[model samples]
Structures are given as C-alpha cells and as structure tokens.
Target chain A: MKNKTNTKKGLVKAAFMSFIVVLFLTTTNCSSDGTQIVANFTEIVMQDEFNTEGAPNNALWTYDVGTGDNGWGNNELQYYTDRTENVKVENGYLLITANEEEYNGSSYTSSRLLTNGLFDQQYGRFEARIRLPYGQGMWPAFWLLGENCDEVIWPQCGEIDIMEYRGQEPTKVHGSVHGPGYSGGEAITKTYTLENDRFDTGFHVFGIEWTPDYINYYVDDKLYNQITPADVTGEWVFNQPFYIIINLAVGGSFVGSPNAETVFPQTMLIDYVRVYKN
Target chain B: MKNSKNLYLKKISVVMAILLTTVISCERELSEDAVFAEFGSNAEIYTDAPVGLTDQFFTSFDPNQGANTQGFGTDNNEAYLGSSSIRIDVPQPNDPDGGFIGGIFLDRGQGRNLTGYDALTFWAKGSTTAIIEAGFGTDFSEDKFVVGTKNVVLSTDWRKIIIPIPDESKLIQEKGMFLFSAGTQSTGGVGYTFWMDELKFEKLGTIAQPRPSIFNGEDVVQTAFLGAPVPVTGLTETFNLGSGVNQTVNVAPSYFTFKSSDTNIALVSERGVVTIVGIGSAVITASINGVPAEGSLTVNSGGNFDLAPTPTRDPGTVISIYSDHYTNVPVDFYNGFWEPFQTTESADFIANGDNILGYTNFNFVGNQFANPTVDATVKSNLHLNMYIPDNIPANLDFLISVVDFGADGVDGGTDDLRQQIFFNSSDFVADEWSTLEIPLTLANRSHIGLIIYENVNGSPLTDFYLDNIYFYE
Candidate 1:
C-alpha cells in the first residue's frame, strides 16, 4: 500500500493541539468568524460499534471464504474461514483472529469481512478504530473496493486502502489508492508512523475524508496524506460507490512469510467503524 | 428487540438536541450573499469564454443529426456551467454506421476564425465509465478530414477535457462539424448514457509544436520463443498530440518509417511489427520526419513451439463444458454456449493451434456453461489451458472468473458468488501452454453457471488465446 517514513514529533504535537481547538469549536456550533458552523455534526450514514455478543451484525457485514491463488493475489498463506473461531464479536469489539494452524490445505487461518452488497457508499468520511496484531508476516487492512468489481474487475474498479499495517514495522501504517495506470506495487501510497509507540500497544483511529476531487488520509485525526486527480496517471475512477473490507492476512507479499519469532492466535481488535456524510 | 428500541430513542434524542441548537442559531441572520460567498469563493472556474463563442448547445441549436440506439435529448436536470447539457443514451453495440452510434452535429456554416485558439475544451459526465472520441470533422461523410481525434474517459462527476489542436490547416473546410463517437462497451447489458456541456475553443497562452515527441517502449531486455511472433506492439507507441496549453503535435504511426538495427536478428515491418528471425538482440526504431524513438528486442530460442494439443478427454460422458473437440459440430456450439465481444477484431497473431478464440484491444468472452444449472460441487477444480502469444506486452494482465448465479439466476444478484482470478505473462512460460487449475470448492460451485475471460492490462490490440476449458473432481 503506502510507503512512508516518520513525521516530526514537534510539528505533530502542534497540529494535534490545533485539531482539538477546531473540534471543540465545531462541536459548539460556532465559527471563529462569528458565523454559525452549519451542519456542525455530519449525519451518520452507517455505523457498527460492535457492542453485541457472538456474531457480527449481518445487516452490515459479510464474509469472503477460501484460499486464493498466491494468497488472494498477494501469495498469502492464510485460508479465510467464516467460522466464529476466526471472526467474531465480543466485549464491545469485533475480533479477527489469525491462528497458526493448518486448515483446508493452508498453513494458517484468518478472516476477511466485507460490506460488498449490504452497504456501499460513494464519498464520505470513513473511519475505524483498531488495535492491530503484531509479528513478522502479519498484514492487517481496512480498505474499500468499487461496487462494480465483478463487472469491471480490479484496478479498473478502483481500490482505496485507508489503513494497512505490516507487522514487521509495528509502528507504521499505510494508505494507498490503486487504479488503471497505478496498481499493485505501483499504487500511489503514503506511510504514517507513530512517534514513540507501536500500533499494537493500543487502539488508534485511521480514516479517510474522501471527496469528489481529493482523498485525505488521517491517523488519530491527524492528516497524513492527500491524493488529488493530479496525482493519478490514468482515469480517475473514484467517483463511483465503493464497499468496505477489513481483513487480517498471514504470510503474504507485503510482510513476507511468518518466521520463528511470529506467535500464534494473534488478534486484530476493532472497536468501531463509522461513516459520515454531509 | 428491546435494546434496539432503546438505541433508536437515544439516537433520536441526540438529533433533536442538534436541531434545537440549529434553530436557536437561526435567529442570528447572515446575509444570503454572505452565506453563498462562504461556499462559492473557492469554486473552480471552467472557462472565461464570452457567451457568443461558448455554445451551450441547448435545444435552440438546429440541424443536429444521428440516432441513438437508445435515445438522446436536452437534459435540464444537470449541467457543467449552465442550465442544461446534451445527453446521449447509448445501448450495447451502438454503431448504426461506421461513425459514432450517436452525436450532435454542430454546423460551422462559415468557419469562425479560431487562429489564436490552441485547443477545444468541454465538460462531460457519464452514467458509467465511458471513453468518447471527439474532434472536428469536415463533410460529415467518409471523405471528412478529422482535425484530431482524442479519447476521453468520462466519470459520473462532471470534469473538464481539453483536446489540443496542433494542425489548424486541417480546419480549412468552411463547413465543418464537431462530432463525438462512443467507444464500444467492454461489458454487456444496456450500456450507459453520457452528457456534454460548455463546448468551446480557447487560446491557452502557448502554441503547440507541429509534431509531438516520439516515445518508443522503455529500454529493457525481452524474450521471444523460437516459433512465436515477437512482442512488437510493446516496442511501438501510438501518436498522440501532447496536451496542455503549450505542447507538440504527434503524427500518426502510418507516416513513420520503422527499421531494425540487425536484419539478421529481427525484421521490422512498415507497421512496426518485429518478426524474430533468429536468436540474438536488435534495436527497433520508428522515425517520423527525422524524430526517432527506439527500443530493444531480444529473441531466445528453445521453448515448446508445438501447436495446441488435441483434447485427450472424451466430451460425450465426461461433462465437458467447452473444448475444441466440439468445434466442428453442426449445432453451432457457440450459439448459446459462448460469445466474444471486443472493441476491435483483427487476426494478426494466433494464440494456439488454428482452433482457439483470439481478441485485440479491450475484449471479453462469456461462456454460459450450463443454461439452467450444473452440479459442479462434485468438481474439485476448474481447469483451462491458455496461450498468450509473445506479442502480448509485459505488465498487462488478464482475468478469468467462475460465476455461480445463486438462486435468483441473475449475474450480479445479492446471493451470487464470483471467483475472479487474475494473471499476467510472468505467470507462464513464454511460447508454451500453461494450464491453470483453480480450486472450485468455495465458489458455491454446485450451481456453477458462467465463465468469463477478459483482458485487463494488456496493450490495446494485443492478442490472447484460450482453449480446453472444463471442471474436474
């Protein structure tokens, strides 16, 4: 996905403070120029707090099962299963558990959940709060795929990876977009790295504020990267609706195969997923 | 159910609180102009053309010709800068004649002097992804001299397109027409509708060069099998006039002369096709009026150059879905079983022994393996042998999919399942047959229905082949 380094800590602290001030003003329904902030709270178009027990809400999620060639195009080693042992909800969170066990001729087992047909949206604020799993060869992602993927196929259908983390670099996450001229390793990507903490230590918010002409990525409300039409080399295909996907992969192209240091039964805990539109 | 009701009440209360706050703030009035200014200050301006030169092409414009297989009219519902845009509804296979399926013909009765203008700019949007060919054509007939044809991909949102015009001399005809032709649909069905607005010519400050820079393929090592045609199109580039305010004009490849550095290694045709003569390396170059673009081609011998093998499996009792064994059957097996759709069809390269289906440019072949239903659950894997001639360029990929129609029997319904597989030339050995074995367990193969072969990343006009497709336990 993204290939970024680290941001200066001093600048991040200053930006964070400014963000807090803006959030407070906007919530209070006031603008600095003495005018009312219209639509202070964007309408919630879709949400899943994962407060229920047992299975995830069926109305908002579906499952992609089986093992694909080269790990679903990336040469991944995990076999995706719909069973609760691999994917489930508990303690106000959705858990995607990856286990070091053989099943269906694969060396590992994991989960891939999607909102392919149940819920798809065009442009809005898409965000998720997640606690990542750590280890070499672990790959976790929250991404979007165009709804017409079946008809137009990928790259042509467009892809937007809001957040992707490779376990080898536990402190950084990436965001990227893939289309006709730019796809696979050639996609437009940017990395966001934490200053002094690893992503697995706690939960962090990753999001994308998408508009007609721009897509701005954020980590815990701090803007990291922005992509515009000028950044694209081929047809700009993000104008159509896209579906959400959350997957935890094991031993794939991005992070390489798991080694002795890798642990078993790793989990990616997701607190919530929310979409807001104005 | 009780918890859901409680959650609903809590959400409603929060919304009510926000509404109450908004109502209270409404008492402090902001001027209507002030509110508009807040949102409109940074709006993008599309053009600065006076009302006379910018023809919105509302219904008032007369003498518009051509028929759409679906329909066409003035749509007041949407526009780029004005109150309306001309909409053309295109259906599958829209070509009524060799020209555009449908278009609005603007009569330039006596050509207005556009001496200072560098290009034509307009706003367009499509119901689906659409590639439209637009340019200035004289005579409106086969003998018309097209100033320049530019392909533009339109999205659902309105976007501006600038077509640079480098050769003004081609616009000498006193009577000319602005035309647009829709590209053939890659996918089947009802097709899509597109809208155009704010058509005008403008001077964008700098003038374009008379000819554009030649861009041959990137310099790299290439491999071609002994008996296969060398990948030549990758070594050739299309002529496109450079875009932007100041740019150069590109002459078509038809005017360019091509040659190979070593005739003993490879022979370059006038059309830029390089045939591998023997094992070695050669530099291929295309020159137009002395400007040249060069690329390297290497031929490697020793690969399976044999023709496609005859199917060893029996078709009668083995539940064969598609195979060349039935090619000569009298019932026309392809009538309802399989069909191919493509933008352009030419037989320049063969993918396999003389019996497989081949395509050029954006193409898709759909096969209805089982009309009502087929119990493929017993089949563990779906197998297909594909032959991508050396002529297909690198970095370009293709896709194969096995579709399960679910209970609804429709392609894209909610319950339908699709197993899409993507591959490139790197996935196979050059000049040899590659058999792809895809596991059919998770695709709900019990009710397997359709199979589709599509070209995704291949260069336009690159040829590919497919044969011996079936499923087995």
Candidate 2:
C-alpha cells in the first residue's frame, strides 16, 4: 500500500510575526529569511536526553506492563512489554521496538513508556527529537494524556498529540487534540510533511507550544498548525494537568492491518524529550 | 589470491569506519563530482527526437529470427510526451523475413556517463493490452550490464514503467541506451502495435530497497569439482517502487562484488564466477552497494570431475538426442515447465566445455523435439548418463516416458503413443555416474517427440545431473 505523505496545505508560518515580538523570542530555523518564533519557552521543566545505555531513568519513566483488554480499547495488536527487547536506551537514543512474535496472547510485542504520576503538566512547550520506523500497521506516537485519567472518563480529561505518525508514510506526521466531543476519529488534527526527506531516514524534532488560549505544532521548528478552544467541538479540557506518553503500537484501526511485506522488528528511536515552561 | 587479500583488508578498514550504524539505511551516499573529464551526461535518450544519440535510432533484431525491421519507426500520430513516440509493429509468426521484433539502442558516441540516474523510465501503451520485455545496460558489444524485466503488462491507456538500475555507481561510462523486445506470441501470433515514449533515464528517488540475490534468493549448496567453472546463476534485484509495485529484474554479475569465505578452497570473481580450486569447502557471497545479497553458495569441492564413459556405438546405428560425440538434431527446449503441477527447473550449465543438464528441485520435467519428429525406428535402446549429485534417496523411483505423436506427428493428438521405463532404488548410487541403457518398451518409435522424466512412488529425488542421451541399437 502506497500512502503519499500529506502535503503542507495548512501551513501557518511564524514569518508573519512582528519584528518586535521576534526580538524577544528565539527561533530554530537555520534560514535567515524564514525565522520562526512560535513561542517563548525558556524555562526548562523536565528533559530526558536518553544518553544512558540501559533501562530508562527509573525516577523519571515508567512502563505499561502488559496488554490490556482490546489493546487498551484501540484494538492494537501488540502486547505491551517492559523488557529490554521491546524498550531500551542505547547510543544516546531511546529505541522503542515493535517485534512480530507471540507474546502472552498477542502476536506482536512493543513498548509504552509514560510519565503518569511522575511528571505531569498543564501547559508548556513539549517536544521530542525522534527518528521513526517505517512500514504498514506501525503506529509510533508522542502525546500527552490527562494526569487525572483515573478519576475521569478519557475524553473528559483531554489529550494533546504532539506528534503521531503512520509508519507507511515516512515523510508525514500528524499533530492533534482529543476532547469531549472531539475524540477518536472526530479529533482535531493537522498533518506536517517533510519535503524531499523522510522522518525514518534521519532525526527530526516534533513539538507543540501550548498556552491557555492555543496550541501551536512545530515540525523541525517550522510551525505548521495551531488549535485553540474555538477549534474544539466541545469543552476545552486544557486546564487540567497531563502526563507524557511515547509508544510504539502495532496494527490498529487507525493504520489498518500489516501486510506480508511489513518488515519486523520496527523501531522508533527517540533522541530526547524535553518540556519547557513558557 | 592477490585480489582476495586486498579485498579483505579493505573490508576490515570499512567495518572500522562505519562502526555500528545501520548499513542499509546509510549506504546511500550523495554523488560527488566524477573525476572523469567532460563526459556526456545527457540523461535523456529521447525527447522530440533522440537526445544525445545519433540520427539512426532503431536497430532491428537479426533478420534470420523473423524480426520485422520495416515495422518499427517514430510515429507522430501517437506520442505519450513529445511530438512522436517509438512504435514497433509486432508481426505474425509466419512473417517471411522476421517473426519477432527485438534489439538495442547503442550510444554511437564514446558512451554516456549515467552515474546519477537511478532508473530507466518510459511511458508505454499497446494497440491492445500486451506484455513487453524491456531494460538497459546491454551495449550489444560488451553486453556486460544487461538488465531485462520480463512480462511488462501494458494497457491501451498510457502507463509509466520504471526499470531500476541495480547499482547506479557502476554505470560510469555506459553505451547501452535502451533495450526492448516484443513478440506476437501473447496475441496468438497476430500483430499488434507497441508504442513507447518519453524514454529516458531519470533520478526517480522513488525506487528504493534494492534486494539483490544469487540462486534466486535461495541458499544453495552444490557439489563442485576442481577445474570446473561453477558460475553463480539466477542474479536478480527486487525493488519496492513508490507506486507500491515490487519489481524484480534479472541483473548481470557485474553489479555485484563477489567474495569467497575461504579463498584457499575456492575463489569468486567480480563476474560472479566461482572457481573450485581445492579439496575443501568455500562459501561464495556477494553484495551490492554494501547491502548483502539474499542468497549464498556453499561449494564442497570433490577434487576433479569423473567423466561418464564415452559412447562407442557406431554412428549409423544411433539417433542422438544430446551428446558431445554426436551431432544432435534440433531440439525445442530442454525444460517445458508444465505449470501448476511440475516443479523442476533446468539449472543446466557448462563446466570445462562439458554440458550437463541439472534438474534442481526436481519433481517432473520434459524435453520436446517436435519441430520434426525424431525417427528412432532403427535404434531400439535409449542410452543416457545419470549422476545423483546429492545423496541417493531410499525410495528413489525414477520413470522416463518417451512419447510418439502417432499419425499426424503432432503433440497432444488423440493417437499419441507413449512408453514408460522405470528405475528402482537399487539402480542408483550417490556421487557416481550411472549409465542407463534401457530397452525400448514402445512398439512405434518413428515419431518420438517428447521425453519426460518424473519421480514417483514417494521418491524424494530433487536434484540430479544428466548427460549423453541417444537412441542406439
């Protein structure tokens, strides 16, 4: 199956920002003319460079041990595991691998690392430098879930997907948000695509700068999307704190089933994850 | 010996430099400026007309093969891109001069440097939907890098076709612009128009994942003899295109960098020819652009080959089918692959000038010689040599059937007669040649057209060798 990467149709560049506003901010764009100052997030809150070569920093990260009922309600095929075979930190990167094999009762195994009660935040600049895997049925995502998820029903707690990629389209990634009436397929989302390049081939930065009023998406510091309270169909649940979640999920309803040609042992490598206070 | 040492040292240094990164993903290095001076780098072979090529474009196949030379030219009425397109009119089988159309387009100049191009792209359509075979890398003289894709199905509507180069870096100075062959066999010997346009080599970054293979991607272990040229065969490259088509093309050995595990036992050439030199074993492997091919060859050398005894019968009393001694008659094909049932393949080869018929994955195979039926009325016995290259199976039951097209001398006719000769397990020996001279079981031998060999009775015979077939009294 050939999935052409989504184009940059909804691109909203930071070049339109006022010169005075840009002077007080910093941008990552190497191009002099197209300077990007999406947000002023200078105060560092939490950061994981994945520089260690062993189990993740225990004090900062935790794992979702086993496959839940119906793959945690997404009907994902992989049995979540904490083993080094599925998740490990090596060579300055966090490798979350999805392997095709029988594990527990599931035919696939992968990892879901989260900072639930460990490090939760309300609004900030959350970003991760990652090099993703490629193939059908592979879903690697970096997103945030409401910290009060146990006390509230899912959409009631809110979700902000900073970066979510369908493995078949190596050049494109989607940034989205799910709320009360905008959950699952009804979520507000926008795609950011790389031109003449692919995320699976090299390292790329995926991030989101969020405030009480709006959430701006950045792929390699080029702001491509923004979602606000007005953009949601229902209640704006952004006031609550949310925890970080980075997972490599196998076959699911969003990406359909894996074909015979899908290569096994797909890995989503994360160089670092850093959150900053604006 | 000289080349292996140099290669070994180079490999060690390369492994040190790359360290532990993924080679498959990092092998794609950007092409820099070539050292060669002022070379022709024209990527386009045809546009409104021939790009860098000369005025004389189309070269038809040999006249003796019934290639209709007059049926090919540029047609302005039909073009997929420019003002005209290349149109080849495939003729009927009974065309007086030529029956099939095929040939190559040569770079009349000192050849063009196509190092930057990744694939040969073209738009094609047929008068009716037809299958066309096309590729490049064959300059007709060296024919070194010939890569051909078979069964390129084209519909009436114009569709683009892409044939990826095995390794673009190898085409430093290439003369072979394009190669194509079209026949009317698919159309039941009738004629059809095949049009191709916008022909050129393109840097289509879409062709990715070059999966090259030897022995058709199967890890093959074969017994070899000293002084025998055990040439590696079945070289191909399978690529996953941007359009989701997995295209596999037969490639030349020049595209690979061959290596032998133990050079003392055997040595492999850049041409992918493996030479069995000693009594020990060696594994031959290859790689393209640092990516290792899928298959390998483990050759177990058995000193020198022990030749089968030469036939001594008088030539007048023999109706030879195949032999080094006798002049054989015209044979149609060595293996008629009866699909859906038969699994055997003719892995035939020549070692030290001796032709050997190798039936690999053997289950059932056939040889037909029906252009003119063989009249073996005078000869009453069939003589042939058989060698079990591998271990002889315990329940080996080999059967040979000789078919005679009775009245009309036509195959599959109602009056066709057949004869069966069987060989039990006791008649075979491992690694030794056995001569089978079976007496004729058929009453009529005047119109014999086909010889079929099959393994039956729960036999596990898969690979074996054959030579010196003749019918003699």
Q: Chain A alone, model 1, TM-score?
A: 0.86
TM-score of chain B of each: 0.47, 0.80
Write out the backbone clash pairs for model 1: A70-A75, A71-A76, B212-B249, B361-B461
Candidate 1 yields a Cα-based lDDT of 0.66
Compute the lDDT of residue B55 as modeled in candidate 2. Answer: 60
Find the 10 residues in a row with the least total lDDT in model 2 chain B. Answer: B29-38
Candidates' C-alpha lDDT: 0.66, 0.83
- Residues B280-396 of candidate 2 have per-residue lDDT tens digits of 888999988888998999999988787777889888788888888788888988888875478887767665677878788899998889989998887778899998976888889
TM accuracy, model 1: 0.35
lDDT of 1 by residue, A130-216 (tens): 999777788999999999998997899999999999876777899999999999999999999776456776899999888887888
**What is the lDDT, from 0 to 100, of the residue B302 in candidate 2?**
88
Instruction: Give me candidate 2's interface root-mean-square deviation.
Output: 9.8
